[model samples]
Target: MPDIEIRQLKKDDVAAFKAIRLEALEMEPAAYASSVEEWVSLSDDEWASRLHMPVFVAFKSGEPVGVMGLLRQKASKMKHRSTLIMVYLRDSARGQGLAESLIDAVARFAAESGVLQIELNVSSENGRAIRFYERNGFRAIGLIPAGMIQDGAEVDEVIMARRLT
Candidate 1:
């Protein structure tokens, strides 16, 4: 694979984002919040809202294959913390550290945005993702029992956090 480049998301790139997001939802249905088919139905405004969350996409030879976002909390008490969401990497982008680069960009963006902590919810069944978070200095903080409803099935979520100084 060629070198992957991680950059901020642009409004015009919503199509690419939708494509990879839908692929992630389809490929790992249990691990995502939305489905591929559902993403396709979302309006253009909904797709544009993604950029507000500090979105970033990874490109390999100009094709987007990885995406992640930092969503700031709305409540005042938790405003210091930003949620890390929508992290998805295509199969071709894996094993090349593209995901890690996306993550590194998230950390930078969070710091710049005045966020002190970055949190994410991961499925309990995805051990590889848990290990990846651990290797990147994230610690499991809590568990959300039956927090996710996927395909009429109840799935638990593991809360993990990484602090930014």
Candidate 2:
């Protein structure tokens, strides 16, 4: 694989972001809470607004191949925590260290921003993803029964967290 560059996505990246995001939703509908239909009709301004949070995209040869975002808690008492969300990598980008690198970038960013912990929720059936998060220092903290509904089926979600401080 060629060198992978990970960087913070800016407002100018709306087009690429929209393309990659839609692809993710299309390719793995069960993996995400949001549907392609929900985002496909969004205007440019609405898409750009989503990037107001810290979203990072991974690129190879200048083409986006992966994306992730860190959402900080807005409440005064919860500001020390952040949630890692919208994590997805192209099929071709898997099995490499790219995901780890993307996660490390988020952890570093969170620590720098005074966040003491980071959390994420993954489908319980996604063993691969659960293992990946565990390897990266996230521990299973709890489980939400029937946390999500996909294709008329109830799916359990495992909540994981890593202490940064």
Best by TM-score: 2
Each candidate's TM vs. the true structure?
0.92, 0.97
lDDT by candidate, in order shown: 0.85, 0.92
Local accuracy of candidate 2 as per-residue lDDT tens digits, 13-109: 9988998888888888888989999999999999999999999888888888898999999999999999999889998989889989899988998
Q: Would you give me the overall lDDT of model 2? A: 0.92
Total clashing residue pairs per candidate? Answer: 0, 0
Model 1 error, position 158 (Å): 0.6
| Candidate 1: tens digits of C-alpha lDDT, residues 68-123 | 88889989898899988888888867887778888998899888878899999999
Name the Cα RMSD for model 1. 1.6
Off by over 4 Å in 2: none
TM-score of 2: 0.97
